[model samples]
Target: MTARWGNACDIVVFGGTGDLAMRKLLPALYYLHRDRHLHPQTRILALARARHEPEAYRRLVRRHVSQHVASADFSEDSWGSFSARLDYMPLDISQRLEFARLARHLGDSPGRVRVFYLATLPDLFAPTALHLHGAGLVDDQARIVLEKPLGESLATARRVNDQIGSVFDESRVFRIDHFLGKEAVQNLLALRFGNALFEPLWRNGHIDHVQISVLETVGVENRGAYYDQAGAMRDMVQNHLLQLLCLVAMEAPVHFEPEAVRNEKLKILEALRPITGMDVQDQTVRGQYSRGRRAGETLPAYYFEKSVDHDSNTETYVALRAEIDNWRWAGVPFYLRTGKSLAQRKSEIVIQFKSVPHRLFPGTTPEGNRLVIRLQPDESISLSLMAKSPGRGMALQEVELDLHFDEAFKRRRWDAYERLLLDVIEGDATLFMRRDEIEAAWRWVDPIIGGWQEVYRSPKRYAAGSWGPEAADSLLERAGHAWFDERGD
Candidate 1:
């Protein structure tokens, strides 16, 4: 690993011995290597600050790969091939001179893709990029991949973007939101823009409201320290939740290309009416989770976690309503909610259409059309519409017209990492978040965060295993809307 192994390589993971490295990046690269999606001569070089030989590093990767890969896809050959492509480089990214080894290893590989994957902390990004630039490692053909919680606020986020932009061109920088790579998420673009059936009706005139909920089954767990610093706003709402909203509210792209799709998303981001001052409490709710049962096992409160602050007011849950002031969605509301504990893990978009002008079946029961798209654990799309109740009378009943991606596709689809890794290798920034998109999200979100600080001064408390605080439910209930639970659970 110390000496140059080969010429061509697609990805170079910097924090290769870290959690994201073993848990996601390495295993993902294995799948690409197996499928021959990666170039034959391509290499996977792992760079970490620790001094570890090739075999030790391979053992580190193999241990994680073995645990993460599905049992069905597990194979000795897969491990052998993937491990063969591994190389290790030990250097402190913070040291400008230390990147010389990386530069030497990457010398004139010509036309081959080179991605500097930053699995490290946000503070290290600028220094790493500067060091890479200093070593002449960043060239026209090279790209850098950045992971999230870009910054705590819009100002900090802008600073990061500015610092990176100083060294690398906009095109060479790839900021990722993994949710964008999820099959169902990308399928959402196709489900709407690619289909004529849905595009015409994708507006305030036809659709009523949209619910984007990201729920987790577990609490902060090992992430307590990081969660306290980030909270739900920075951790999930700023990136994951906003990305989902963009996909839902964006106008139809002219073509499905990067610019076209991103242009539409940018419009949605720009059109987001700010939530601040008087609107903060009316439109948003922040809460912290207390001790409660996770899965029949009792869990500690956030304060009890190893590195957490006992008196922290950081929210474990955040729910808010946003609107695009543009004509297409002028009055339609988009509700965004995310929280840990008290929810079976679920991420879905519930499109609840307006009730009919009049209830023709007044004395009986009546309902409007609705559609639900579930992304995690399973991928499915179902349209809720009224249908006959099977007796002789026209007793109306709501039935779902369903299409489950799993049940129908019948293929053991690759995980999000697999697809994203392929995209990185193939030089497709289609699903990656662009700079404007990142800043735009922070711009819309920063105000609500500030308003929360100025107003409530602290988050409402809700027990673990419960659906957030009463304020959360009231946020929607006042608008005559309710949250949707996991389908059929």
Candidate 2:
């Protein structure tokens, strides 16, 4: 289905010369343009401190775009047209006076959809918004997109929200968590709410537990400085994993509109059982990776990584058991784990159903049914169920009924940013986070961080190539559960 593209718009990307823009945002826009999703008259104006002419900036963008964008999608003809829409304006985001130049570049195009994508640090979010407003850049039809790691804590998140909210209304603010844009992530809503198969059985009585894991094979590479300050909790758990949990656990929205969908997600965040005091110690595991091997190559520990503090107590890995107090998922626990320098790179959500009341086959043990929704490496959904052996008396084995996205759908799969950028242009906030939703998540996450600071002196150590610390296994073992290893089957 083609998305409804709005009228000609201006997408002004702040920090356009930065890593995120060069690697992700630009390429995503290129794909949108290639697929004919972008309006013909749409203009992509890049604002940054780097002084470069429009042609020079386009050439610089071409190198990164070619490296990141797939060769199959990158045609000379497409790049020619895509580059025409790209413009560069050298202006420091911190300086309010420079925004007037941007305003002149944009001109007084009435009713033009203006999007200011702040791809810079969280500190710049407010200042950029204020300057945009001061320069008469922000209007009723204008929208602003804020990147992740919104703040260090709830108080700071509120401050950032207030500043951004001052310029743009809640409806026009799009706080992006790129994970929300994944095809499988959105398919989750369709699998539950759109289909009649699972919604009836999506409760504690039917589901035994849920596991959400986002493991990375590579460490903090060049983001060591940011990784040190944020760690796994603030970086991944507070936003990505919690957002995933809400989608899996939230009650069906009355409608699929922006507010209706986000309102239900907010309810889940508020209903989350707080992990504090002794519960933090018992229900959470924090770890830092040590030297290990990956693909026959030696890898350094998190502390030894470039730009990282050698004696930092910051955690590179976190595993927590989360519970929702609502009726739908009252007793069910959500096992959440995310870390760097792990065994493999994969993000998946496992929904294990309750076992049968009685064992029909005395000789064979029946495995419980499970729905595995994989988000990376491959986007697919597999239902695991016990089936009778081909030639045997009362013999059973677990088999997966799979739907691999690439194989199931013979079409080009879009990168997360592609869909998300398009949504912003179309003024659809369905996939974006709302103000209340952000605050609610931080409210649940803040206490756990405080508890860790007060109690734990240091993060546990685990080998770089391993899944996580031994404590993570123990966290699940205590609940009579285990981490589902995709490679095992």
State the C-alpha lDDT per candidate.
0.84, 0.92
lDDT string for model 2 (1-489, tens) is 365456899999999999999999999999998888988899999988999999999999999999998888788999999999999999988888988988988999978899999999888999999999999988899999999989889999999999988889999999999999999999999999889999999999999999999999999999998889999999999999999999998888898899999999999999999999989999999999999987788999999999999999999999999999988999999999999999989999999999988888866457789999999989999999988878858688889999999999998889999999999998999999999988999999999999998997599999998878999999999889999985532
Model 1 scores worst on lDDT over the 10 consecutive residues at 1-10
Model 2: worst 10 consecutive residues (lDDT sum) = 1-10
Best by TM-score: 2
For model 2, the superposed segments whose C-alpha errors exceed 4 Å read 1-4, 486-489
Per-candidate TM-scores read: 0.95, 0.97
- The regions of model 1 sitting more than 4 angstroms off are 1-8, 486-489
Question: What is candidate 1's lDDT per residue for 287-335, written digit by digit as tens?
Answer: 9888887557886776777788999998889998988899899999899
Candidate 1 clashing pairs, residues 3+ apart or interchain: none
Global lDDT for candidate 2?
A: 0.92
